[model samples]
Target: MHIVITGANRGIGKTLAGRYRAQGHDVTGTARDGSAEVVLDVTDTGHHADMAAQLGDQPVDLLICNAGVYLDKAERIDGYPAEMWAQTFAANVTGVFLTVQSLLPNLRASQGKIAILSSQMASHTRAPGGSYIYRASKAAALNLGRNLAADLRGDGIAVGIYHPGWVQTDMGGAAAAITVDEAADGLVDRFAALSLDTSGCFETYEGQPHDY
Candidate 1:
């Protein structure tokens, strides 16, 4: 199986890449700093184009849209600047869309699946009020993945939006509830279980259905 993962330089993405490689699967990991097999700043369409060109018709069995930002984590209710919202949305929402769009042909070729790593914060049921930008962006990403599943189902592509758990990563922080390996392992199973029948599902890393 050929897997493509964005933001694979660290955190859960890196763990997933390592796990897949250990299982003897072909993995293409992308990072903005060129540390991985492909250099991709997901917010950049030109980078997406370059990535697609580099892959050049390689069938992608799984495309993991894991690149995202949580810039307003420390911001107060009155502190989130407009530029911060723009930057966060650009990375967390638009970036996901562009990656999927650019890789559409590859996904179609392989009849692959898409796994979007949104957050539980994206859920309307879990509104704790802080990190508004991140929450809204993730919600948009969830919506994007759901609609993409509908549109791509005819082409034999399945899309599943997932909350990768409160993981102990830089973004999730050291106090997070789960280890990176735990999140990655659960997510790998969730990704494997995704099908057209469950394409538009919003699920947790542990494979439980999440409220939209």
Candidate 2:
């Protein structure tokens, strides 16, 4: 299997890359600084094109859009800045779309699975105070994944949105609920179970259904 993961130099994405590689899968880890096999800044359109060019006709069995930002993680109600919102959406929402679109050909060749790493916070039913920008951007990602699932079903590509548990990573913080390895292991199963019939589902890393 050929797996491509974005924002993979650190955090959950990094762990996923390592685990997949260990499993003997051809894993490509992308980072913004050209420090990875694929240097892709998800927010940059040009980088997406470059990535496609780099891969050429290689088959992509799985595309994980794990690149995201949480700029307003601790911002209070009145503290959310306009620029922060735009930056967050650019990375968390627009970036995911661009990656999927740019890699469409590769995915089509392999009938790949797309995993959008949305968050439990993306759910309207789990609304907690703070992290306004992160929450909204992730919600948009979930919406995008759901619609893409519908549109890509005919192409044999499955798209699923997921809330990787609160993991102990730089983004999740040390006090988070689960370790990076734990989340990655569970998510691997979730990704493996993805198919046309289960596309568009909002699921947790542990296989539980998440409320939209």
Location of the lowest summed lDDT over 10 successive residues in candidate 2? 127-136
The candidate scoring highest on TM-score is 1
Off by over 4 Å in 1: none
The residue-by-residue lDDT of candidate 2 on 186-206, one tens digit each, is 999999999999999999999
- Encode model 1's per-residue lDDT on 68-118: one tens digit a residue: 888998999779999999999999999999999999899999999999999
Clash pairs detected, candidate 1 = none
- All candidates' lDDT scores? 0.95, 0.94
Candidate 2 ranges with C-alpha deviation above 4 Å: none
Error of 2 at 191 (Å): 0.4
Clashes of 2: 0
lDDT winner: 1
Model 1 — TM-score against the truth? Answer: 0.99
Q: Estimate each model's TM-score.
A: 0.99, 0.98
